[model samples]
Structures are given as structure tokens and as C-alpha cells.
Target chain A: MTSSTTLRQESVRETRAPVEVRGLHRAYGARQVIRGLDLRVQAGEFLCLLGPSGCGKTTLLRTLAGLDAADAGEVDVPTQVAIVFQEPRLLPWKRVDFNVRFGVAGTRGARAQALAALEEVGLADHADAWPGTLSGGQAQRVALARALVREPHLLLLDEPFAALDALTRIRMQALVRELVDRHRPATVLVTHDVEEAILLGDRVLVMAEGRIVRDSDTTGITRDAADAVALDVLRRDLLRELGVGG
Target chain B: MPFLLLLAWQLLASGGAIDERLFSSPAHTAHALWMLTTNGTLASNVLVSLRRSAIGLLLGVSTAVALATVSGLWRLGEELVDSTIQMVRTVPVFALTSVFVVWFGLGELSKELLIAMACFFPVYLNVHGGIRNVDRRLVEMAVAMGKGRRQIIRHVVLPGAMPQTLVGLRYSLSISVLALVVAETLNTTSGLGYLMANAQQYLDTDVIFACVVVYCLMGITADLVVRVLEWRTLAWRTGVGNR
Candidate 1:
């Protein structure tokens, strides 16, 4: 067990950068959301942006995903990028399978791909189920499946698991980690949860006032170490950054 | 309960509590219905009305959809057409009937054209609103997924706007029928409306009542057909109907 664990740790340590955003800025009317934000996501690496509400983490992620245009600066992204919003945002009129394969153009093999994606998310049984009938967690899983099926090179998540309960959130986090590792896509996750950042991210970026304050490598820490030391340290550091605590 | 109410109405009319001249007894109305059915005039008039309504509905809905699509896609087109339609929609169908009769003469063309015009605005407005009201996020998602304009329209915009369009279609259908009847009365020599108008001249209240009943039945049937279409086309929106 120790040997296998060490092997896993060593593998994750060798990260390759796939996406680079330099001095990205975004402003909504008078309020500047993301200002001079610079981020680099390694290929096959999980990076989490931790911040308080309105700290511009989501804005940064959206900018990276190309959903929101950057006000200034450059973003070098892969041709294929997928985003998972806080809400599932599934097409309510489509069944689970169709929603998963919504991005797949043309009809000939779309159904087959949709079914396969549903199977990947463990929702094959719900292929024909309407999106309205899905639970929150289930819907999020479908959304993740939707992103996954696109075979994206860069995956941006905007507090996707924030609304889920503790246990379901953990399960989903593990599922996401597994899928990311399998797909080997460069992933950027935005969240306010320090533990989540420490548990799932190879690197944790701390943001405040529309700028990144710190970027820490947590790749060397094991899950138990993350829970015991890394998370607590990151939490204190993030709180301090926000002027909440010393 | 409806039958009981009708029976009560029949009793009152037969007892002379209601004037038989204006309010014909149910039995007399039923007898008139039977006579019309036997004479085949009712069936022919019904066929004529049905044909006009079907043509008007088809033309109205297709034209509305085509116009809405074009306008929704192009800003300049929308600006030009939207104001014009809104202005025209304010003109009452009854008021337009005389103008149509004068322009097209006392024929099926005038009646059909008037019905189509009446049906056009409601559907066009709803479809336009539906397209405009589509969630921007969904459109962005589609664009991110590399969907072209046509694909977005086919997969996202049409489906999202369907419920609202269907509601408009239902309203337009009923309006079409009402307008068709009025148009028929004003211009055509045949149709249920014409039969009722002629009966009124002779003070044939039973025939008038029978024609009115037939009109109500046609309206109800049209509504039911639309409901069925809604159910079938929007099977994806099963529970969303209540909303």
C-alpha cells in the first residue's frame, strides 16, 4: 500500500502546463471583477482557486473558459475547453442522455455518445429521464459528464460542488478527481473551500480583490496530510488574505 | 352537471318562464339539429367552415413562424416588422372584415384571408417573445460547443421557445375560428355563420341556437387538437406544462 501510494504521489508531482493566462482583467460596468489575474494550469493537473464571495475566482474561471471576455491581457487556451457552472444548466427539455451529448454535433452517432457519457457518470439507467427529475448532485454529475464528453483539453469549474451537501460533495469531488486523472485534462476549479482545494488540487491559488495573492503547491501532501495540516494552513492563509483573521 | 343545467334551461323555456322566441327550448334546438343533419346542409356548412379554418390556420402559423424567425435573427428586420405588426394587431378583426370583403369580394378568399390575418399576430408575437427570451447562458454554451447559427436555432432556440409559441398557437386558433365566423357572416353565402345570420332574418331561433352550438363544438374541438399537438411535440416538457 505504501509503495503504491508513493508511486501515485511521484506521478502527480510531474505536472505539465497546458493553459496560460497573463494579466487577465474583467470589469462589469463600474465594478472590476478580475484585475490583472495571471494563471497557469498544467496539463493533467488539478488546480483550485480559493477565495471568498466576489473575490473574482468565478470571473477568472469564466475568463479562462472563454465564456466571459477578458478586458485586457492575453489568454492562451487550448482549442477545446469545457466549463461546469455552479448550476447544472442542463437543457431542461432534453433527457439525461441527450443533455450529456448536447455538444456533439449531428445526429447519427450522437445518441450512442450520449449513452456512453451517461454510463461514464453512472447515469446510464437515467438516459431517458428528464432533467427536472434529477437531484442536485445527479444534475451536477450530468453536467460534468457533458463537459467530459466534449473531450476538452481544458476544463473550468465554477464552484460546481459548492451547493452539494458534505457527503455528496466529497463523493463528487472524488469522482471529478478520478475523471480528471483519467482524461488528463488541465483543470481549474474555483471554490471557497480550503479543504476541497487541498484535497483535490495539485496547486491551490488564493485570490482576493480580483487578483491572485498566492499560489501554493500541495502535490506532495497525502489526503490525511491535507486534512491535518495543508487545509488548515491554507484556510488560515486565505482568511488572513481576506483580512478576516491573523 | 352540464347536462343538468341544460335540462333546467329546457324546463324553464318549456314552462314559458323564458320567452320561446328569443330563448328556444333545448328540445326545439335538438329537433332543429336533427333536421339540419337530415337535410345535409349542416354537414356542408361545417365542411366549408372546417376547410377555411384549416387553410387559415396553416397559412397563419407558417407565416408567423417564418416572419418571427427572420425578424428574430436580424435586428434591422425585427425593428421594421415588429412596429408594423404591433400597429396592425391593434385593428380589430371585425373592423377589418368590411375592408377585406370590399377588397376580395364576397367569396372564400376574403373570409380565409381575414381569419389568417387574425391568427397571425398572436402567434408572431409569442414566437418573437420566445426567441428573444431564450437564456443567454444556453446560447453561450452552444457557441462554446462550436454550434453554428443554424444548429443553435434547431436545438436550443426552437425547443426553448416552443412552450410559449404553443400557448400563442392555442389562443390564435380560437381567434381564427371566431374571425372566420364573422368573416363568413359578412361576405360568404355559405358556412355556419351565414346560416345563423339567414335564420335570424326569419326569427328562426332554433336554427340559430343549433348553429351557435355547432360553433361552440368547433371551438372546443380546435382547442383539443392543439392540446394534443402540444402534448406530442413537447413530450420532453411533460411536467413543465403545469408551469
Candidate 2:
């Protein structure tokens, strides 16, 4: 029994990185969307992908989430994965709790589990409310809760906070950071906002024309906006990579 | 406003400005309605007509929903079925009465089939359009969550198409009633149309008007039933006075 337990622990540790990709290519008819990309996300690491609108960030995210197939090359992801898109994408016909319960099995205590998820998002009082009736921030929170309830090995976020106002976006970013730390998923967040990438990521990758051009580690940098020197230097470097004037 | 219109109609008929033989006053029509009710003809005819409409609507709407679902979910099904429906819809269904009578021998089958034909197209067209118009992003989200095809259809596609399907039901219900009126005119031994046709031999315009009133009531009542159903099933929808 002791030997078996040791073996299981070793296997679990070996599978720490939930995503691995090499030479991944995707295209739409004549136009290529993602071309010859390679990435790996270690367990409990938060990696942010910063890119312009047509720079294949969303395409890469979709391929990672298994929502789209790659045209060529090898891509491996864990079986359990969740994604939160820019839109909340809740079913308008379902109540808040039911939408959260969507991916959950209908076995015993499913409702309780759903309610617990809602509680984590500060929406315990709105479990029975229609999704259409909730404010945009609350709706996005429910979406986050929906993704988190699955306890996924990997979590993919496609600019989820883009539609939110600045104040709400900050709060949601905090919530995501807190949740990712607690749940310990290998997370990949695709965003156009360089500051968001800096604040939320352990590592940031800047992409241009469907290829990663720069990779930076922010492990020693403080995320606080008041840390003007470090934040400014990081922002200037990212802007230079993106070919944007600082 | 209705009462004022009735008063005006009555005054004009009694004053001889309009020929009473040609156009019955509201009072005359009310008298005819009372006589039909007292003699139990209205009750029996209404029951017969209701039964026919119910059975025909059941057949038509169920078949339409089934076909729409099949076509909406699969490209092959759409390619196989949609063009035929479009072609058949272009031909007026009401004008098929003679062909139906010749095929079915003027029995209740002919009338019921006519009603079903009238109800089928609008329901199928709207439901097909609705299912096709469901947001692709939502479908992708469901797929990402590992939802199976059947689960996605049941949970996402059907409910997404519901609002438009209800609109189709409202339209088809009115069309069904209109088709019923036309079908009941053909060798109907026991319906409002038969009663009106029998009275026409005697030039009884009042009974004709009474039948018109019953048809109006049926249309209004069907619309109200659909409205109530929409209110109950689409409770999550907020716009259009739901708030």
C-alpha cells in the first residue's frame, strides 16, 4: 500500500504541466491564424498572452481549450479544462444557479455544489435569479464561478474582463488571481491590455503576426500600480515589442 | 367604441338607409346567436369544430417541430428537406381544397388534412430559422464544457429557438382557424360553417353574422392561449413588458 501511494504521488507530480504544444498551426481557408507555435503551462502558473487584435491570441486560446482543431503539429491538454470568454455566455433561459450547474453532473448534491460556487462569487443571494436580470459584472462573476466549479486542470480566459468598466475590471482581476491561486490551475489568459498581463501573470508573452516575439518574467516585479518604476519599465518593454509608442 | 359601432349599425338598419335583408343589424345577429344557443346548435357545432382543430393542430405542429429539429441540427437533413418545404410553401395551401376533396372523398379526413397543411409551413419555417440563428459562441461554450450533442440540443438549441417558435405558433393558430372555416364549408354535417350555409339558403344574414362572430372569438381565444403559454415558459425573458 505504501509503495502504491508513493507511485501515485510521483505520477501526479510528473503530470504537473497540463498543457504542451509544439509547432501548432491553424488556418482559415487561405489565411493562417496560428502558425508554428510552441508553449507549455506548468501547474499553478498564470501565463498571460498579450497581442494585437489579429495576432492569433484568440485562435491559440481556442485551440488550447479544444474548441477548435489545429491544422498541424502536436497539441496535448489535460482532459479537464474550462474556459471563460469575453462574453459571459450564460444561457438566457436558465436561472443563475442552473447555468452554473451546466457542466456538473446531475447526481446527488449537484444543486448544493452549484450554490456553493455562486457563494464563492458573492452571488449566493442570486442563485434563483434569471441570468438576464443580473448586472454585467454579476453575470461575468457567475461565468467565473461556472468555470471554477469544474475544478479544471487548465483554465483558459479570452479577454474576459475586456467588456467591464475599469473599476469592475480591477475587482475581477483580483478575483481571478485569488481563485487561480486557491484552485492551482494552469491558467492562460489572452488579453490585449499589457498592464493586465503584467499584473496578473507570472510570465508574459508578446505576440506579433501569429508568432511570439518576446517572453518576459515578472516574478520579482510588484503588481501594484503605485510601483511606477517597475511597472513603467515593463510597460515600455511590452509596448516596444508590440510596435506601439509609449 | 364597440357599443357605439353597434348603435350606429342598428340605427342605420332600422332607418332603412341600408337594406336589412342584405346586412343584418347587431341586434338581429344577437337574436340569432341566442336562438342558436337555446336550440343547442351552437354548442354542438363549436364542440365539433374544436375537436377537429385540436386534432389537426396536434398533427401539424408536432410534425413541423420534429422536421425543424432534424433539419436544424444536421446539414444533410436541411439539404434534403428545406428546399421541398420552400417549394410547397409557395403553392397556396388553401387552394388545395378541391384536390383534397377528390383524394379523400369529402370526409373529415379532407378537412382535417387541410387544416394540418395550413398550420405546418409557418411553424416549420420559423422554427428552422430560429434554430439556425442560435448564437455560435454559446454552442462553442457548451462544446468546450464537454457537453454531448444531445445535451447541447436539449439544453441550448431548443430553448434558444423557443421565442421565435412561439411567434410561429401564434401565426399558425390564426391560419389554422381560417383554414378550418374554409374546410368546414365543404359537406360539413355539423359545424358553424354548415349552420351558416344552411341559413344562406333562406337569406338569413343574421345567422351568417353570428357565425362570423364565433370565428372571431375562436381566433382571439387561440391567440390568448398562446400568449399565456409564452408568459409561462419564457419567464426568463425580460424585454417586451416582461419586467
Candidate 3:
């Protein structure tokens, strides 16, 4: 079993390619959300876009997912891309299995693939449940499973666990880490939580006023201990930038 | 409170607090009901009215849904039909009844047509509004997931709009019943409206009251049916029963 799992992991690691973005600019009306932001994610890297509220982290993620058009700059992305929004955004009319399979080609194999994704998220038993019945954490997990099922070249997340309770958020962070390790998709997660960013991301990019302010690596540090260090640094830097504290 | 008022009305009539000739007692109306049932006239008239109303409601709902969907989804189609419908809907049901009677004659056809016309606007507007107001975020999610237009409509638009559509359907059903009664009163040979009209001509207040009672019962029955349908269709909606 160990040998087979190792082979599977190696095969997954081989499939991904680095994603590159250059001078990305997004504006909504008169408000400029992202101003000429440049970023890159190496193949199989977990990158987090960490920022304060209204800092355009979500806008960046949406642009990457191809859901929102960038006002300026070019983003060269792989065709295989999936996104998990902050809200579960699951179809209420569809059962859990159908919601996960939604956007996938409609076939028997697609249903099987959805089931496998649910199992990976530890939600195989909820395959027949409705989206409305799910707790916030469960729903977010389902959304994650939905993104994972696509086997995306780039998995973009827009604060997918922001609504969960503290305990559930920690569990979900760990679950995401495990899933990323297994799937090895080059991922970009936008978040307001500094600790979450440090815990889940191989590389963290801090944004302020729609531009990258800091970039750092937290490869070996676990999220729990790394939280305090990352939060203290990020708070001081963000406060200084906002002119809240000198 | 309504029940107590009704009871007071019964007491006032029984005690001759009001003239019996002008307002027949509830007991007299109940007796009239028995008489109509015994003669089978009430049942027959009710069946005719119900049949016409049901057929007209079915036709109106289906046509409105089809038209509203087409217009809602397609810009050109909406522009083509929107002004026409808005203009037609402004003309009262009574005004159209005469025209329908002229075209289809004073038969079931004319009455059914009038009811269908009466039922159309409420449903059309509700369905159109529902489709138009669907959350753009959900649509964005579906599109990002690679859903085609048809799939989005079926899986996203339809489900999201169902609650509003059902609301429109319930309103339309009540209007259809009202239109059927009014059309029958205007130019129908058979129906509860005919019975009431005939009773009124002879000043048989009891039979008139009985017919009115039947109309109320039918309206209540139609509402109950719609509620059942709403419950079935919107099983996924939270706090549905409370609403």
C-alpha cells in the first residue's frame, strides 16, 4: 500500500507546471483593485495571497480563475484551472454527488470521479445530502472537493474557509495541506488570516493597496507555531502601511 | 375574530336584530345549500366552473412560462414581446371578455380565453423577474465550472427562479378562478355564476348566498392545492413551512 501510494504521489508531482503572472491590473469603476501586480507559482507550490480586507486578494484570485476579466496585464494560465469561492456556491437543487460532478462531462465515469473526490475530503457519506443541509465547514469541504475533482493545473481559492469556526478552520487548513501534498496542483489561496497563510502556503505573498508588499517562504514550519510569528510581522508591517501605527 | 363576527351575524339574524329579507340567516343559507345539493344543480355548476378554470389556468401558466423564459433569456425576443404584453395586460379582463365572446361566442371557449388572459400577467411578470434577478455570483460560478448556457439554465436559473415562479403560479390560480366567475356572470349558460345570476333575478337570496359560499370554498381549495405543490417543488428551501 505504501509503495503504491508513493508511486501515485510521484505521478501527480510530475503533472503540474509553473504558473506565471506579469503586471496584472484590475479595476472596478473608479476604484483600482489590483494595480500592476506581478507574481509566479512554481510547479507543485502552494502560494497564498495574504492581505487585509479590500486589498484585492480576491480580485486577483478571480482573475486567475478566468471568472473576472483583468483590466490590464497578461496572465498566461493552463487550461486546467479550478476555483473555490468563499461561499460553497453549490447548487441547492443538486445532490452532493451531482454538485461535485457539476462542470465535469456528464457521464458514468464523472459520477465515479465525484465520489472519489468526496471520499478524499472525508465526505463520502454525504454524497446524497443537499447543500442546504450542510454545516459551513462541510459545505466548504465540498467546495474544495469540487475544485480537486477537476484535477486542475492551477487551483485558485478565494478565502474558502473564512466562514468556518476556529476549530474547523484549523482542521480544514490541515486537510488542505494534505490534499495539496497529494495532488500537487500549483495553488494560489487568497486570505486575510496571516496564520492561515503561513500554515498552508509554501510561499506567502502579502498584498497592500492591491500590490505585493512582502514575499517569504515557510516551507518546514507548521501552521500552529508559525501563526504568532507571521501574524506579529504582518500586523506591524500592515499597520505601518495603513499609517495606523508608526 | 372573523369567526366571532360571523357568529354575531348569525345571532343578529336569529334574534331579528336585522331584517331577514335583506340578509338571510346562516341557517337559511345552509338549508339552501342542502336544497341545491339535493337537486344536483350546485354540483353540476361547480364542476363546469372548475373545469373551465382548471383548463384556462393550465394553458395560461404553460404559455406564460414558455414566453417568459424565451423573453427573459433572449434580448431580442424580450424586446419583441415585452411591449406587446405590457400593453395587453393593461386592458381589463372585462374589456377583453367582450372581444373573446365576439370571436369565440358565448360558450366555454370565450370564458376559458378570458380566464387565461386574466392569469397571464402575474405569472409572466413573476417568472421574468425571477429569471432577471438570479444571483450573478452563482452564474459566475457555474460558468467558471464550464457549464454551457443550457446547463446553466437547467441547473442554476430554473432552481433559483422556482420559488418566485411558484408565487406567481399561486397568484395566477386565484385570478383564473375570479375571471371564470366574472366571465360566467357576463355570458355563460352554465356555472356557479349563472346560478347566482338566476337566483338574483328572482330575489332568491338563499341560493345566491350558497353560490357565494361555494366560490369561497373553491378559492380556498385552489390555494391549498398550490401550497401542496409549493412544498413539493421547494423541498430544499429552508424555513419554507414557516414562510
For every model shown, the clashing-pair count is 1, 0, 0
Q: Which ten residues in a row have the lowest lDDT in candidate 2 chain B?
A: B234-243
Q: lDDT of each model, Cα atoms only? A: 0.83, 0.87, 0.83
Off by over 4 Å in 2: A1-16, A223-227, B239-243
Stronger candidate by DockQ (1 vs 2): 2
Q: Give me the displacement of residue A246 in model 3, in angstroms.
A: 6.1
TM-score of 1: 0.92
Model 3, span B137-158: residue lDDT tens: 8899988887889989998998
Indicate the residue-level lDDT of A121 in model 2: 86
Clashing pairs in 1: A16-A43
lDDT string, candidate 1, B1-243, tens digits: 999999999999988899999999999999999999999999999899989988988888899988987787689979888888888888887787788888988878888888888899889999999999988888887876777888889888989999889988999989988987787777457888889989999999999999989989989998998899999878877755443
Positional deviation of residue B60's Cα in model 1 after best superposition, in angstroms? 2.1
Error of 3 at B57 (Å): 1.4
Please write out the lDDT profile of model 2 over residues B110-160, one tens digit for every residue.
888889989998899999999999998899889988898888998899999
Top candidate by lDDT = 2
Query: Residue A71 in model 3: shift from native, Å?
Result: 4.5
